[model samples]
Target: MVQPFSQSRVKPEQNLKSLSSFNEAVRLLRESNSIVITTHINPDGDGIGSELALSRALRYADRMEDSKAGLHKPKTISIINVNPTPRNYQFLDVDNEIRTFDETRDAPTILQADLVVVLDTNHPMRLRTMEPYVLRSNAQKLCIDHHLDTSNFADVYLIDEEASSTGEIVMKVVEELTSHQIDAQMATCLYAAIMTDTGSFRYPRTDAELHRTIADLLELGADPTYIYDQIYDQWSPNRLRLLGNALSNIRVLYDGKLAIMTVTQEMLSATATTDAETDNFSTYPMSIAGVLLGVLLVELPDGVKMSFRSKGD
Candidate 1:
């Protein structure tokens, strides 16, 4: 039998505070003329999805405002990133709006923008090559993230540590800005964001309210089965062989409490797979019985990349 999931309720006071922050973020969007939106380097579903969703919502709002006021000018919004979108996530950017940063072209736009919005990551360092440009920008900075231990860099921040993903917060912002009018594209982007960050709604923070929010997304045209297939089921044959190699290399230690898997460069070369293909490989070790901690190490040309996952507190 399936058991009911427990809830992790946010305090009423926290809701009020988050509301206030959302309102302030909306105000900044209304005031800005040119906006540059970016996310952390080696971007994941959460970052890329949030960026696309927010960008669409902002454009929708601008169109409504322009129609109301009989104006011709629309706000300039650009989605720039230090790294290109991962292959699995490229489908979300249907219009191909995301740009891989070219300093000469993007630096001028970042510098001259009226606002710079950083999503899914709070710290500037996470922005990698784009960090210096963001820091040097005279534009008002706004950060929308659910990560903890934020740096004091952004001029306005909407950081909700209790939220499941940055997509959850961006959804609220989209709701407020567009008056609950989210289209299918925005819904798909947001669904991908929340789904990936919450580990398909199985993460520790997947509460009732988060499910309700996801339900709302479904009504707005987010196809869960399709999105899931696109994200997790689209692996190449080579990638599956790579995973097989990793699983074969797993070793148990410390009385079977720890499970470790390594994906060496040789294996990657032989399988014709890259480190990105090993995104959730750490979960495999944790699937073993009696294993409390799972670790995945992938060897790159320069160094070894490590991923860790644990079962409990």
Candidate 2:
């Protein structure tokens, strides 16, 4: 199962150790002529949003430089991912620039890039089949992530586990790149990334600063109510039936402290739903009154998939 984007947050000051590396990353971006940007497989909001925002920022910066230098050649900035963007996130890819990786088709593009920016996750394994090709490339790797690094594969790791989301870190980098200018598109993507990862500003890491950042995003043309509805409210009828089918199998355990819900392929077929429609199904069990921990078991063709959500440590 895909993991939730939310994680523990450290103080922002704790990330100061990577300041030098962050500077190096920015310098590399300035020097590189061709760049490739990628995120983890089955990317969630943070990964996709950060990638889009960074792509836009880099292109804008490149255009600005071209204008100043009186050069007409364009910098190639490719935003490729191991998995196709999900339906819900297609709105964020306004330019239709995001591409799905294919070994034969995208291999040359990945290899020829002067720099590759891996966002949201530092682990190379998250790159899936593209990991080997990325490793083979002579391109310098830069990671901008909020997750704790278990493996250091990138040449420059601009990691900040305290960041509310990778988009938050990308926001700062965009500011540096574009001289503190964030357009409506950048604002919308970053706002969605931070909002979803912070559980709609209800999560533990959502501080006053984050709220202020959100306010800035709103001022930049991010519509809070509309974005929220686009992400959460536009569920299909089949999805609602699938949720009902899963809820019908809910069971209590350990004196109501634990709740378990199971959804089989048969249930999906019966409800005329697909795995995509079942997004956030794990949250249902956690919403039970006395349930401290919720577990969702989904039966897929490969095997049974499990997701766990807990209220406390």
Candidate 3:
């Protein structure tokens, strides 16, 4: 079984290594005049939240620097993603800064930017349609992510696999960039990112430090109740019915150690719900008594998307 949160503290050496990357990344941000930020295709809460929060923080820092130097030219920052923001996460983009990538328009921006910041995923392929452009760009690339097995595409990498989410790592960077002056909007985005990726702080990597970070976010104006409601409570009636259908069809196997749930295209059409509505369906199977592993298989037009949730190592 996965270890308890109390037993999963981050190692000291990991912090030191992460700090070095952080320093390099901050220096690059300070020098860049124009920047483009993006996340993986079909982004989850962690990716979207980190992208928005980091972009906002960078712009805020630029404005502060401009005021102090009496310079009107602030760094130009654009958030371009391969896919449109999910309906649920649209609330966090309060300023509506996120733009769906258009090759004709965004290609030039990517090529012209002094820096390109890729959040959440480390692999360039995860950027999908934007991958070639990102690779072709001469801009200094910086990747901020929490996943393992990173590609060497970026000029600077701020990666911490031990982090609960990319949002957690971005929180530290935001603090350093803004001098601990995180605003309410940024706090809300980070809170949503960390909360969702940590499964509401119940995941294995969640620990005292993570909770402390959450507390800091709350004090900075992240409303947990509101964010939770916005993300989970806003599900459509058809979406809830789709979940019910999936639960009803769950198949138990291996003497109750495994549970499998399948959502076919027919099921989706019947319920008038799309595949995106099946985000957390795997969690339901893992919640069953005596089940060690849960598998959610969603059949799309082209292929099947599989999600796994397991209780043990």
Clashes of each: 0, 0, 0
Candidate that beats the other on lDDT, 2 or 3, i.e. the better one: 3
User: Residues 124-183, candidate 1, lDDT per residue (tens digit)?
Assistant: 998887899999999999999988899999988898787889998888888777888899
All candidates in order of TM-score, best leading: 1, 3, 2
Task: Give the Cα lDDT of each candidate.
Answer: 0.90, 0.85, 0.89
TM-scores across all candidates?
Answer: 0.94, 0.93, 0.93
**Model 3 worst lDDT window (10 residues):** 1-10
lDDT of 2 at 115: 95
Give the Cα error of residue 2 in candidate 2, in Å.
36
Report residue 178 deviation for candidate 1 (angstroms): 0.8
CA RMSD per model (angstroms): 4.3, 4.7, 4.1
Q: Show model 2 residue runs off by greater than 4 Å.
A: 1-16
Model 3's number of clashes is 0
lDDT by residue (tens digit), candidate 3, 213-304: 99999999999999999988998899999999999999999999999999999999999989989988889999999999999999999999
